[model samples]
Target: MGGLLLNCDIGESYGAWTMGLDAEVMPYIDCANIACGFHAGDPSVMRKTVALAVAHDVTIGAHPAYPDLVGFGRRSMVCSAQEIQDLLHYQIGALDGVCRAQGAKVSYVKPHGALYNDMMANPAQLRAVVEAIARYNPQMPLMLLAMRDNAAAQAIADEFGVTLWFEAFADRAYDALGRLVSRNLPGAVHHDPETIISQALTLSRGEALIASDGSELLLAAQTLCVHGDNASSIAAVQRIRQALGKTSAS
Candidate 1:
């Protein structure tokens, strides 16, 4: 099997308001990063999402985020390492509880939104996340962004005896350092379906991407993240999955 697994951020619907085409994209994804009620999703949404993932046989991952329901967990907040760990445990446990009800467990963890970006940029924050997962369940892997040089992150994960699944974004732009460009920046996100699919294929093939700074950047990623927030994005994900199937077979 190919080393690359397809994952998507899903189960983000909050209360009566809904988000994402979770049902439409579940079949194509290998991992479902379900929102764990902190950023988005409530008990009902979490239960429904976990059931859907179980039905589709997709690996369930806890999508932990800062407690920012109003901000959708996209706004960064000042938090200490202990606080970060607390947040992770709270969110993961909530999702795991929902998953257990459906006879499934949270197989992994992928921090959501600002917390994810914060961990990538701050080693202390990353360590807190890793430590949280390790303390909860050492077997569960922690998914973080794939960088140009992943040695530091790997070292930290190794220290905690936690497995790391370096993830790449096919629909997002990267900087020279292999960090994702800010959404506020121009051309930070790839909008075209063809561009998104091509990027997915490139990363799957272990090829280099042209960074936003016009530099060659390569990311060693074990999973590729695709967004399912809209119809056009879902269409791109479908094409991406089909294209990746050929790459995997080859």
Candidate 2:
């Protein structure tokens, strides 16, 4: 709470399939954007992740996605606003139930994968998401990508009386428009620890980033999104935590 909060997508293990070093990374992250059933997590996984988060005092956030288990919710699907709203309600409710059993509750909402991209690129999808959050719990903040110009998204959230938490990636390259560079493209993700930590520090200081198109992009973000899927990613998160701590303390 003292500085830019760190969040990670976690609890993505399915039956007989495991993903992410949840326990190893939970201690370093401030928020957990746990996967709901539609994406990767099952009931058991959700409950376990919620308990772990509660134990670590990390905030739980519902990571809802399009009903695409095969694609890990990264494939876009055709869905109306109403359908999207329904999906949001169903996923959030399921995760909230799991959290309740563990004496914890989801503190925020963050769409996953393709849904996240669609919402940022489509105003209609964004409005539907905002509306869903407002109706579900106006107090709950919706976490979305922070861009060079957040005014449009902010206006939509303002209309619904919903709080928005602009998020930035510390390890991903951004396009000139401030959207993340496509993962399919080369150099979309930063692999070097120095580059990742440097980007984190720059964002924490509200400094400009060199976009893929060589433009200076400033993202006004309230939180930083980090990954912890494997040993290397976990190590990066640790380095980010340490680097940010030094920056905050100074």
Among the numbered candidates, top lDDT falls to: 2
Candidate 2 C-alpha lDDT tens digits along 12-37? 99999999999999988899999999
Cα lDDT listed for each candidate: 0.91, 0.93
Query: What are the runs in model 2 whose C-alpha is more than 4 Å off?
Result: 246-250
| Candidate 1 segments whose C-alpha is farther than 4 A from its true place | 246-250
The residue pairs in collision within model 1 are none
Q: Which TM-score value belongs to model 1?
A: 0.97
- How many residue pairs collide in each prediction? 0, 0
lDDT of 1 by residue, 38-69 (tens): 99999999999999998888899999999999
